[model samples]
Target: MNAPDRFELFLLQDGEKKITEKIFTGLSNTSDFILLKEDHTLGNLIAEHLKQAPHVLLAAYKIAHPNVPEVMIRVQTDGTITPRDALRQTCQTLVQMYFALGREFQKEFALRQFADQGDQGGAGNAGGQGGPY
Candidate 1:
């Protein structure tokens, strides 16, 4: 259902598939708790990374049903940031880290290539002359 004040909670079901959506107005937070889903890897990954965010007091997922692959996540912040914001920040940080790691790897690869060329006696001038130009 939709709330006038921006906060709302509702359930969406399609045959055997169901999802509970929770929305918080003040913090502008929203999350979906999935039930009977075959894969909970994305929820678990988000929980793992959201825990490292600043002001995040708790970020975890749980399996509520033993018979089904039901998973729910509760992300809490210290009033400084919304749970959605925290998760967004965490994802941004991960992207930044991934780029930084890629840059580092490129640098290492370039250095290794230079070393290999040196070992192959290609350190001198490109021409056949061994001149110090």
Candidate 2:
């Protein structure tokens, strides 16, 4: 039997974020299934991040391999946002998180330095009393 032609469907697009559905007609019937199996975890991560958007109604990704591997992504919104917007927001949130962590590290490092200086000063003032005779 001849394989069908591969095609992609766009379920939604509003000049911004878009959802794409890809159909891999004959790939799923192959003996190697590792890539397809790994895609499930990747798709779940994407769906979870996309759902963090405030205007997102629903976001999901699935791979069907009954005969061939087909990937589908459906992202619904409240008409006030797009998938692109949600993605941008997610990136911004991640950046903010990283920045906060860096600041905390800097604060901790400064505190450690201050404590070490105080210890050194106190030891110097002890006038060789390092060991209790």
Candidate 3:
């Protein structure tokens, strides 16, 4: 079958706003969140993180179709917390993880750069003579 014709729904243009809203479910402690202009990258990440939350009973996400750029994430939580709280906690955890990853990456990058500089014989090499170790 052919894809949907709504290109604007999938594409983000200048001055366009990103949308995220909660869809209340008939059952308590369960809700669906809609995230527009997102794809599997975010959906999978969120699902994985949500699954890690102790209070979350279920966490899943799907796209209606590949043509659609929106993700519908359904979360069911225990009575201890709401789905919104689980999602909020997931976001915070993800942000902290991201920062930690960046910090580790910077440290590794600096180490690699220092190693490379050392290999290049780092300054004070006159007349291309090898220095004594």
| Candidate number that wins on TM-score, 1 or 3 | 3
Best by lDDT: 3
Please give the ranking of all candidate structures by TM-score, highest first, separated by commas.
Answer: 3, 1, 2
Worst 10 residues of 2 by lDDT: 28-37
The digit string of per-residue lDDT tens for model 2 on 13-111 reads 234233333333433311111223234554566567767767777667667664434345555656576545655576587667668777776776676
Identify the runs in model 2 with alpha carbons over 4 angstroms from their true place.
Answer: 1-49, 60-74, 116-133
lDDT of 1 by residue, 1-133 (tens): 6543322122333465544545534343434445445336656776888877778877777876654456776777787887667767877887787787777777766776777677895564433322121
lDDT of 2 at 91: 56
Which of candidates 2 and 3 reaches a greater TM-score?
3
Q: Estimate every model's Cα lDDT from 0 to 1.
A: 0.63, 0.51, 0.80
The C-alpha RMSD of each candidate to the native structure, in angstroms, is: 13.4, 15.4, 9.3
Ranking the candidates on lDDT from highest down gives: 3, 1, 2
Candidate 3 similarity to native, TM-score: 0.74
Please give each candidate's TM-score.
0.52, 0.40, 0.74
